[model samples]
Target chain A: MCVNMDLMATTLPLLDTAVAKCCAEPGSAPLDRDEADAVARLLKAVADPVRLQIISIVRCSEGGEVCACDLPSPLGLAQPTVSHHLKVLVDAGLLERERRGQWAWFSLVPERLELARRALGT
Target chain B: MCVNMDLMATTLPLLDTAVAKCCAEPGSAPLDRDEADAVARLLKAVADPVRLQIISIVRCSEGGEVCACDLPSPLGLAQPTVSHHLKVLVDAGLLERERRGQWAWFSLVPERLELARRALGT
Candidate 1:
């Protein structure tokens, strides 16, 4: 059976705690400490140059997903470094990772990106 | 003479270098190193919990702006600590700082937030 990683991630207890604590429209009112921390964690996940580039590349990929092997060349980083960045993104629920045979394929999590955008009040 | 701090920050040579390099619509194509770095800098500026709260407060303030003196009570932070976060936001061009005789008033720079939103492709 093919399990849906996105749904699984959303339902994970840890992510549920983090994601559920945020998403209040930032411009509508002052965010309390918990809301601010949750939003900040999401922003920090994408606050690195390599990670931002990775997100952009994944966002614009032709098939809507990219294999782990395909990312290093374009990012000009080694496999370990790229994998490290990918792990951070996955942990933050910004990217979904699927195992296809020996390699991992990564895809953007649109809802997470939308949550970050809304947190910015834009 | 009352000068417009937003315009001045937007035109500053250093800020111009950073802000001008990004905003290429992250979903359009892969972002180059410079573009990623620029956008990362902006994200890093607002990646902190205190800074995000400060931005939300200023954005939702009663007069479309807020006095520096009024921030501490809402934030439950010391004046110097709050001021540091304010400086980071101003330096990132995300907030405009205006001097009003004995205090500084902060307001949102809607364009910068929009740029960040676009960079996230939401």
Candidate 2:
């Protein structure tokens, strides 16, 4: 499951506090239980080669969204597998998908990527 | 198994080329086979709750390092479990571990984290 910053902050005050403080002044403290869980969920979503490529493809799409029909051939993955990875990314809040006609178009959620980058203090 | 940037660049020029070009100009293209594999390896390492906490703890340590003995208590995880996580991070090039007397010290690899951040264009 993807944990958004707002939900995480409200649901996990301790972790939210830690993340806020850490972001303001990094290397100040370790992530508490809830914080780690929230961050881990996001990281796990993008932890696979296929998923990473999917993100890259959608991110680089000319129209800012990629059609599901256009993905499998570039990565040499089957259509079903590509759809599965896209589902995982969408579930993790990293990508937004829209069904138009017979195609599913995916776009990158830059904020979520930024959150994970900040969590790693990158 | 963990994949390092250097090995990936040399072994998979197609992906390495994509990464180099992409890094120079963000969102220019998708990750080829090797680049995705290399990045996925690193992301997978930090994708777990315990491992993320461990990295956070070590990064925030006073001495720029933390002893293995000190991790379990703060994280509330079993010692063996913590060690296993540490090993995974080390293998992924995200953390470095050195045995000192009776304890193993772990430290964050900031450059590696930066590489990931750049990869995500965050």
Model 2 misses residue A109 by how many Å?
1.2
Instruction: At residue A23, give the lDDT of candidate 1.
Output: 36
> Listing candidates in order, what is each one's chain A TM-score?
0.77, 0.79
Return the clash pairs for model 2, or none: none
TM-score of candidate 1 on Cα atoms, chains taken together? 0.81
- What lDDT is reached at residue B41 by model 1? 80
Clash pairs detected, candidate 1: none
Candidate 2, which CAPRI tier? medium
- The deviation in Å at residue A22 for candidate 1 is 8.7
In order, the Cα lDDT scores of the candidates are 0.76, 0.73
| Residues A34-118, model 1: lDDT tens digits | 6677678788999999998888788667777889999889889999999999988987788999999999999989888887776
Query: Fnat of the models, one by one?
Result: 0.64, 0.66
Residue-by-residue lDDT tens digits, candidate 2, A52-98: 88877776776778999999999898998988888888876789989
